[model samples]
Target: MEEETDTEEEKLLKRQRRERKELQAKIQGMKNAVPKNDKKRRKQLTEDVARLEAEMDERHQQEVEHLRLEISKQVEVESLANGIGKLECEDGEKTAQHSRPTKAQKRRDKKAALEKEREERIAEAEIENLSGVRHLENQKLGHVLAGRGLQIKQIPSDGHCMYRAVEDQLKERGSMLTLAQLRSQTAQYMQGHVDDFLPFLITPSTGDVYTPEEFEKYCDDIVNTPAWGGQLELRALSHILQTPIEVVQADSSPIVVGEEYSSKPVILVYMRHAYGLGEHYNSVEELKDRTTEIG
Candidate 1:
């Protein structure tokens, strides 16, 4: 539907462009056709040129108005769709409360947990200026982590930060993993547990929820390309590694993937202002020992 609408809009725009060009050419021709000494003819030519210009301007204004209306209509549709989706989710949650031990119930629970984290567990919207960390603020957060016997291990600010951070965390625990392998594993995990991840899989670019097919392509991208990881990927990694992944931010409470008493040690990551200008990731860990001093 969106593609069809875009195609129609493009056709209209192309028609308008052609019309404007013709009007310009016609006006220029009329002006050039009149000789300087032919005053009466020149006056008539000028009027004709002005009339053509007026038509062009009117067409331009109409096109602009049409585009504005189209944009307004799209916004309304998107708003309505979002509202309906929210209501459906609410209704599903109400039903899930009384649901049996079926697959639907499990899906409902996963959806609820994921939505809660996406909406309320993290305060990521206000931390958009992630060009780099503020020294004073980073120091404060670091001190807090240090008090908890942890410190940040800086990772490269490249687009692969998230993958690198996860790899580093795994390596520290005696596993030599590469970013590519981790990405592949994460993609595989998400594919195998589609029901668990599907409800939470939204396209960041479109702000639309993903269909299973769309998600499959997303999984392929994760496996075949070096895409930056986000919350969904983090959760997928936790399942893939069978370890609880904990993400601690400066402002929000830590997000945990599994129970605190789980036998597998928790993997910790510290998110700084690491991803506004460009997305990146960093690992937070127990303080390193250097001559018995902590890093």
Candidate 2:
């Protein structure tokens, strides 16, 4: 009968601890869901959580007191014998081991959590650093180009910068051509004139010449994916638009890649050692004629 009573008391204590844990979880959920801007709702949630916390604390105190009283009764029944006292102390130590984390365990858990947070912050800082670099590079380019009668308009840096820059230049010239359409047209031109591009499209990774199959796959990526453009795409676009493509670099003279076989003229502005990376292109436009007009 005594053993059965002890088992029932242990089960009751376990249930009380489980209930307290559940209450703690609910309180945390309510706190998170309550928005700071909603003053009335936030206050209501705060009060509810506080009330639940108070009840949990009171229950915990009652359980602790009950356990103390039971231990005292057992001590008296055993006539304060050393064996009974040692057994009780051992049981108490076991309970402490199960319920409380050791200092070293707590430190390890805290260290792991802090390491994860540091990695997340570092990732964010890297992205911000890249953006700042791009912004500074643009300012420097604008300062140099303003001396001439031109300034560069920034385009989206998503591997599609080349296509977007060309599109921007065309838009200024009163033509509305989407990047996708231009990509498709350029791919078709290259496919029709394989001999011109096939030699250059040699597999860079393997140092082997491009097979007809590999060339087709590469063309597909240019048209469908967000792959970047290079001299080859510029040449294809020039042929398709039937215009000369002029790229003005920072260190060298203007590099004209396509023939001026048609009436349309396209000028591309490029900056070397820009954005702390490779060369990048921007759309060039002429400022309004201010030589004759007075301020």
What TM-scores do the predictions have?
0.49, 0.54
Writing each residue's lDDT as its tens digit, candidate 1 over 154-230 gives 88754467788878888878987799889888999888888877765545346467887898998998888655566
Segments in model 2 whose C-alpha atoms lie over 4 Å from true places: 1-104, 113-136, 262-264, 271-280, 287-295
lDDT of 2 by residue, 136-177 (tens): 756665555566667677676555777888998899888889
Error of 2 at 66 (Å): 62
Candidate 1 achieves a global lDDT of 0.65
Predicted structure 2: clash tally: 0
lDDT of 2: 0.69
In candidate 2, which residue pairs clash?
none
- Candidate with best lDDT: 2
Per-residue lDDT value at 132 in model 2: 79
Which stretch of 10 consecutive residues in model 1 shows the poorest summed lDDT? 122-131
| Model 2 error, position 88 (Å) | 34
